[model samples]
Target: MTDAERIARVQLARTKGVGPLTYSRFLETYGSGLAALEAFPERVRASGRGELKLYPADKVRREFDETDHIGARIILSGDEDYPELLGHLSPAPPVITVWGNTDLLKKPCVALVGARNASAAAMRIAHDMAHDLGNGGYTVVSGLARGVDTASHNGSLSTGTVAVIAGGIDNIYPAQNEKLRDQIKDTGLVVSESPFGHEPRANDFPRRNRLITGLSLGVVVIEAAQRSGSLISARTALEQGREVMAVPGSPLDNRTRGSNGLIRSGAILVENAEQVIEAIAPAAPSQASLFEMPDDDLDDETLEFSEEDRARIIQALSPTATTIADISLATGIPSRKCAILLVELELEGIAGSLPGGLVRRQN
Candidate 1:
């Protein structure tokens, strides 16, 4: 928690290829951010990845300073105030930059996500539901996009709301949401995992969606297309063991297909805020128990990988997702060794990890 430790943690997290999962593992193995950074180069070399690229110390320090100047604060993963529900993510963000009402994060939250080009009826439903939920003592959470997200936040601003942005805490996307963003920053909460001044890219939405669902006790889908980011958030909620709820819509509307599909697939079917509250009420005690961070106590005993072993593991992977267990069986590598090799491959940009412990070739 000291200044030096904060800087080191920021550097390690911002380093290319060291994602949330890898960051947590490094912290567990090295016991400190400074120790992890000092050992990273050697670890990369031992993994057959040659030298690793690290973020510059000066750049991280500058980011920290700018965050302070903007009146926002950086909350590290292990901090006392970090949202406990979010901290339970398998690869929870190592750091989140916040602009306001960090205390709202401790309250029970339900995510309301849906199509950005949503119908008027859907938007009204979302708005009213948000207001009702807020009045009922639940903080509403959503991505700060257009349509449903905007309506959700607007409805709950007077009570409590949380906006998880895809860009940096200060970088407002959709340009139109700038004022709304500022309003939330003043009365509600604005959060982002991205560092200062980083503009959101196409790939950042899914990452941001994960945080939306991760910070909540449950996720409710208002109106989503067959393939949409709202569905992605619902999927993440399911993966995180959070409840998923969906509002049914007319079968004629394409926007309702994804949400309808969710209900068919066992998500709770909800119409009003009362149903949503009823669904999550009984889950409160169990949800509290589920917030325990995943244990990272894999045996730290080093295991060397031969060139052939690495090649075989790579050959076993494809663009199609495969579970780590399947990869281990296919390549005759121990599961733990396969995991280490996969992390190395991820750092090298040769592989990527998907939800549900799945892995796929980056190319």
Candidate 2:
């Protein structure tokens, strides 16, 4: 994107009703950030959302300055040095505010997510896993929360860590992690999809969860309640078709319920770092296979798709729910054909056909 494009991209991104998916749609039709910005209001009108109140160039310029003053820089997707795996995410964040050794974004990343108030054992597991992963050349990824998240980063600090903050890198929430956040800025990394200097809100956590896994090859849940944020990361990892691992805890501990259930339902059960390592080993070759997957495996493209194909497949489904037949009806493809496409879509990437009739988009 050009300078005007970046500014327009930021404007649409920060707009009230423009989500990443819709933003991508606008870009797809308009073909440039400036064009997309110009077209946003009309799209909003079509959606019956009333007129779009876009951020003017002056305000967005101030935001850019604020981000730079706070020692954060904007990293747009598809940039030369963007985290390669993160770029592959559908409708990935147009830009992120990053602080610290942003270069570490290229390193193999494994997310360790768990309860904000995790148990001592879970915290130790997270720390050890981070250390071992770092030693094995993986940059640990996690939120900058308490418990397992903090422990994971501490263990990987020497090697490297990536914290996807729920708030701006400059606006450290929880207050207790202030010093650690500073340390990460100096050594590891901290990033958020939100604009510069934006504070954390209740809504930011789930959005940040996607980036937590987006930056990593896999996610490991230490100890999480059924409703924990850690589970959010694990689920996102699964949706991304990245490995999902969980550490088992005793059934008595409510904190372990989420992870234990995940394991029971087919998530990789991680007793130690070995399990996590093995699970992501298949992705290692993809390190070179990041952008342009080798065609030598023409019959071998693991699971890939064109954007147009993705849209057609998604349209064939329902938001409430649907089966292969329903998807076929929606897409006008035969059931067998739909299944074949769904299988390919699953292998190439998540087709959003989870067990138990859950039909949705990967996002």
What's the true lDDT of residue 285 in model 1? 28
Per-model CA lDDT versus the true structure: 0.86, 0.74
The best candidate by TM-score is 1
The weakest ten consecutive residues by lDDT in model 1 span 285-294
lDDT tens digits, residues 1-363, model 2? 677778888887787655664455455444678876665554444334464588678888887898888777887765686777777775567678888787787777889989888888888999999999999888899998999999999998999888898876678777998998888888888888886667889899988998898888889999999888888788777777688999999999999999999999899899777788998888742323211111122231233434565468766654455565566566654443344345434333344544232445454
- Which 10 residues in a row give candidate 2 its minimum summed lDDT? 289-298
Off by over 4 Å in 1: 285-342, 349-352, 355-363
lDDT of 1 by residue, 131-239 (tens): 9999999999999899999999999999979999989888989899999998999999999999899999999898899999988889999999999999989988888
Question: Using Cα atoms with residue i matched to residue i, what is each candidate's TM-score against the true structure?
Answer: 0.86, 0.80
Tell me, what's the RMSD of every candidate? 3.6, 8.3
